[model samples]
Target chain A: MLFFEGSEKKIEVVLQPGQPSLRQLEREYWQQVVAKANATILSSVHNEECDAYLLSESSLFVWEDRFLMLTCGTTTLMDAVVSFLEQFPADSLAMLSYQRKNEYQSHLQKSSFEQDVTALQQQIEGVGYQLGYLDGHHNYIYHLDRPYQPREDDATLELLMYHINGDTAQYLRSDNQTLEGIRQRLNWEALLPGFLLDDFLFEPFGYSMNAIKGDRYATMHITPQENSSYVSFETNLEGEAAALVLNALLKTLQPDSYDLISFNQQLQLDHQPGIICVDQATQPLSCGYTMRFSHYLKPPSAERSADRLSL
Target chain B: MLFFEGSEKKIEVVLQPGQPSLRQLEREYWQQVVAKANATILSSVHNEECDAYLLSESSLFVWEDRFLMLTCGTTTLMDAVVSFLEQFPADSLAMLSYQRKNEYQSHLQKSSFEQDVTALQQQIEGVGYQLGYLDGHHNYIYHLDRPYQPREDDATLELLMYHINGDTAQYLRSDNQTLEGIRQRLNWEALLPGFLLDDFLFEPFGYSMNAIKGDRYATMHITPQENSSYVSFETNLEGEAAALVLNALLKTLQPDSYDLISFNQQLQLDHQPGIICVDQATQPLSCGYTMRFSHYLKPPSAERSADRLSL
Candidate 1:
């Protein structure tokens, strides 16, 4: 199978008070926006507080006053961001943040992080910083420089796992795998808990899901290709709830390395026997939110047969 | 120290029969060409058969009727190629070959391999092929498709080593190291016996050298940074002569992994006790030249403390 760029481009924006509620926008309109990035909205689900789209590439979430859209592959995410920005007045965006994680094969990408930031700067003023090392698991973050107060409840946690191991990863690559089988394998009842869920199993090998409960949302995307397996779990859940989910996934996936990124949340990962922190950075974003990034890896000395997959 | 982009871009071309000899070109002219790529020609050495230039970024060698230029860093080697192509008559080129190895940090580069191929195609018609997996160590090759015969002696071998280890690596990285000290550390008298060598040692860390014996040439470039230590050895010698040099360097460097690329040469690498071939590919180009690429690694199970450096 051809290698897919599993790393994602993310854009999150909180609209000004006078702006129209993004949730009022129709599904067709959102589809058009997704299409700009060369991706189609496969399906979507809604709850009282949000609409979650399962895209051909990744996912999109829209709330009353804020929205988050994420995409992978060679999708021109900047095109979608530029299109969305053009629809509203420049001043309509109260707080905006753009983030990109380093990809496995960056040469296949159409635009670099610098190019994306350049495109975003044309529409709005922002500050950009790179966290971690360029040659390793790192991230590029850009946020609006204007002063704006963030909601106390606004928080997000992202867990990106790489080189997944064990029977679950093998099961994911095997044939005869069903959506229900994957759900049971993931044990969402224990991990996600009390949430309306929607997910899809891609042909060949891959998986994606979106869940919503009350005003909080969570999404997961899994790429099980042997050479570059990656799984990303993201949520607005906070504190112990988020930590429990993260720990459960770690136990199930058994990734060789993983990165944890949190926005407006102070996340503390307890020391695991074999796992070690490789690098980390904490930055106060200009958009009135604090961002923390940490990369942890199972050292080769502690490696098991399953965790020794070559990258 | 900043992580220098160790991967290189290489271009080789043969001029038509009636064209002016490139050797007649003055150092000032070649300096201008190198300048276009944002690199300075540090020093140069010349034998009766060729003029070898040790560039700040990489190396360049000019022969009577042909020339080869290889550059690293974020240098725009395409700009230099375009400038050189513009100087000659469109039909004055008999054969041209351009090759680029997959870089460790391609996002930091100014142009992709495809972009370079497009730029080359603008000057002359050619065929291109990718030799290995994009997510792994690979090479992109483009050569003129026009009818032309290669010299019986025209052969090149490239040994690209990664994650070098042991005393040599530590010595290279240590402060207060001098050119004579590095030369002795590399044991040029043993590795490159009977050859006249010109070498340079970078201020903080790094080493480069050019050697010539009669008409044949060999060059070595080393980047000794902790995160991405790399050493490349290339020569125009054939068969056992090339293999001997390759084995000697491999013994000294003790790289965790390496790639062997040869043009117009059939290289046979004897199995070492712990090293194994992970992936390989062989392709015949339209220019009537055969190319072979092989990637070898010392698996983690056999890893020594020296070979266990994190990539």
Candidate 2:
């Protein structure tokens, strides 16, 4: 029988073939397994306990001087648990001793809530997210109805990729193996750009995860400027406007085809109107026309009569 | 014989194509020539004169405008006079008012010797060429040597090379036609190191005739740290020691020849010797050899002393 820990509670065990009941199994055998698993969790949690707090109930539990907590879950839940355990292990509990009890609890609650909010926000904001406020405050509080859809494989890959070096290509070429082997040859600078160099840390390409297929070719799409205006409306209003224009342009043009879009005061051609894109290039757009508006006119005699009546 | 002005006195002449008497030339012709030359000299003197003083030629004579005279060697004197006259037209003397003085002997005797000494002192100290001192107090001093240097044909082009754009390649590529042409082709950033952007004002390349040249290519002999203990005598001794060792190593190996000198310490090989010869790379040397020094051992006595000192 195996027990799994979930976000809120412990999962009930469903006995498997050849597995003994709790009474039949030797106490020492279970104790040893629990101790070994706890040690593993402790070691992993050393530096990153803040990120690993969720894993506390999943990998091990506190029982007297020691703790034993382990459970099973859906593959997605398992991956999340594993990742959390990996980043923040049981050993991280030592670091917690230095933190004030109230402060630590508050910090843990705030971070956990933030993680949940971020996950929810990202899901709700997909494609087209409304830009409005419920009250006077500028709070972009996301609607909780659209729960975050976690991709287990992507989550796992992202976790692994975070630790993988950028120059893993060299090792991959040498070994001709996929996954773990490539991960073992990580350089801290290549794996974590910002950690090594302050300038590269915030760059779009710095935190990108390479997509891998089982027994197939790996593909990587670098978001060189991932936070560009087109990706999210949550960015600056000017950026949002720019993104809107780009999205419209991308929709109008077919991929792998090239065309020059000239914009003037009036549409020169009938087929497709060229949109006026913002100037991101070094050179100013030539033949650009400024849009002008005028109010409808009335007769000079009627205007004079209206002015005289007002006076 | 053409009359050419020498440094001290004007050379008067009559072009006879044979031996001619010095006094054979008509007084009016001599006066005409003298008037024309004197007008040019006076104009040049005004342009060159930064300041002036009113002084009596003698107690018998009323106080009038007096030129603070400059003395020069014959060759320099001729060059100065020629340069001054060449700047203006030949018949410029008719524009100025002239008066003849009857008491030449008395006027010459009353000339201020003290004023001449003061002018010479100011010239030496880089001052007082334009204005004379009144009652031994300093006044406006014109820089005479400043305007003396002759401008070359490519003077503006040279200035554009060393300044405006500072692109040596562009300056070389542009046909020595016009200043604007050179400016259009320049890529200033490529020529100068990014750190030295402010120091660009002080042109390292000699653009002006008086500009000094720096030692662009020099073999700086550096002693190895192990052989020389005195090398570490400076404050921040650790940093100095490392720089000396690295500089020596760079010079010996000439790593710059292969363009491998730009690799940061973390990417560099340990077995590779210390000496590296860099060409234009003037990045301040860093403490790269600290890790390498760990492999080497200090003498036993020195180690013991270090331990004792620590206690």
Candidate 3:
């Protein structure tokens, strides 16, 4: 059972447009922080004033004001988070959402081997972290202080990660299919229309592409190693286009199996996303693509007001 | 994406029970050969005269006079194969159906860093080898010499491998349920009655179990690491009972999505086992387990007589 992680640790930092470092010198400071984590910025793009950096492990997106940083493998993201805050003391940090898949914990701990999560938990003071499987698919998620403003009308964006069939890896390693041919077959450009996309391929076996339109952007990274193979599709847009993007991504990846992990920041307290398995989703819907299971990661309750105040 | 291989080099040696070193002192000599492959016999069985050794990565089954050995990981299984032939020079070697998943090739090359498969291929004289994907899942299988006897009424047995959904991994690693509880809930005893099963739990993570009922047997291996999680169900039995055992195993595993890789060694030219996917199998069938894809590997035809005679 091969499973791929979209990101080992994803930190969502939201800030108002007025912050001094938000617009100026953001790249220089954050690049150093990325270096601190021993990861390389393979490629980057600028759409209007916003930018996206496709890192060796994960991804980083910068809007006009907000910034999203995600890292996989052995990147010391927690330590980098400490560096980011120090370099750019926010006028006011609205919310910080930090999440990591359970398997990548070993990678993170490679450098910080002497210290476990308890010590990292101490590093994350006021912000409370919940560590457990999210969306009920063995993928673990960790959230920090007031990760999202739960809203009645919020239709949260979803990040889908597919464990592509081993054929992708075999193709990458072999010269059977050119990268352009693959992109065309997958409808990569059509999926994320209207953008000058930046794409890159790792020397050994990996593929990545990122694009941005105004402040809304999408990016995909594929690790094609037999031991670590996964195709990740992510976007920050909403409404009808978002659903289209998810479906397009699925069709493009053509994963033998996939797990859809969505963190709905704003779900109505009473609304429940019905649990859908692989069989149910494949019936009337698209090809073999199926939803494994879907559920809120324990909806934030009004009874937890005290918990929010602690932050 | 993570894919697991339970074999690097598998040697299927069929010898008559009258050989010089057929049964007694068989283990002492073979243990040295296994040691050369850098694997240990984790747990095994001694049913009267038959024996089965579950290796660290693969398996070895010795029933009556038929010896089957398979190795995965960075084990030098090819080198061990040569030593095996030297140690037990059989009066007449009926057949050798050696196979390996593609990923394990790199592991075999690790020990004899300077030499490659071409060298080993040359060394394996009198035995023609064919390398390609078996049952079409990107798992390369190598066959040594003539493997099967094609017949008019040959109803060959097939052992299938599926990539289960990730939830099974979470369940295995969970502290929510104990192993005993899981066994009871799975109806473990009913699946294989009348056998003293030997089971072992790999500390901090994995689980494995093997049982021998006379000459017939069943074994399960679970590598529950979140990144590389899979539950493989394999049994060498046939008929309606085999189908029942498969359903029972699927229910016990309850994988969200799985791919069935089967290799039916012998079969009547006109007999075709239906390809059962997620929809057809899971309809009235028990549990939430669903199949991904099933297909017959293009069988080697009688037209390839020259290829057969090349050996």
Best by TM-score: 1
Candidate 2 lDDT, tens digit per residue, B167-266? 3333422335243332223222332212111111111211100110120100111111111100000001122322443333333222211111111222
Q: What's the lDDT of the predicted structure labeled candidate 1?
A: 0.82
Query: TM-score of A-chain in each prediction?
Result: 0.95, 0.17, 0.70
Model 1 residue A7 CA deviation in Å: 0.7
Tens-digit per-residue lDDT, A161-213, candidate 3: 43344444467646465668557755756767786677776665567777787
Candidate 3 chain B lowest-lDDT run of ten: B302-311
Model 2 chain B weakest lDDT span, ten residues long: B154-163
DockQ of 1: 0.09
Candidate 1 local lDDT, A1-311, one digit each (tens): 34677889999988999888899988888999999999998888889999999999999999999899899988988899999999974699898888898887787788987788888889998877766543346787888889888889889999998878899999998998999999999999888888989999999989999999988999999998875788999999999998888888888888877899888998776535677665577787767887887777654442111111111
Q: lDDT of model 2 at residue B46?
A: 11
lDDT (tens digit, per residue) of candidate 1 on B1-311:
35788888998888999889899998999999999999999988898889999999889999988998989889999899999999974599888888888787787799887788788778887777776544446688887778877889888999998878888888888997889988887778876677878898887778889988877889999998875788888899988888888887887788877899988998877645677665577787767677888777664442111111111
Candidates 1 and 2 compared: the better one by DockQ is 1
- What pairs collide in candidate 1? none
Per-residue lDDT of model 3, residues B1-311, tens digit only: 23344324556665544665455655877687778778888878778745778777666767655677766556777677667667555334544444443331232135422132344454442332211111012232333333334223212233333333334445676756566755664456877777556666665655666666776666666755443355555555555545666676555554433334333422122212322232111111011111112322211122111000000
TM-score for each predicted model, relative to the true structure: 0.65, 0.13, 0.54
Ranking by DockQ: 1, 3, 2
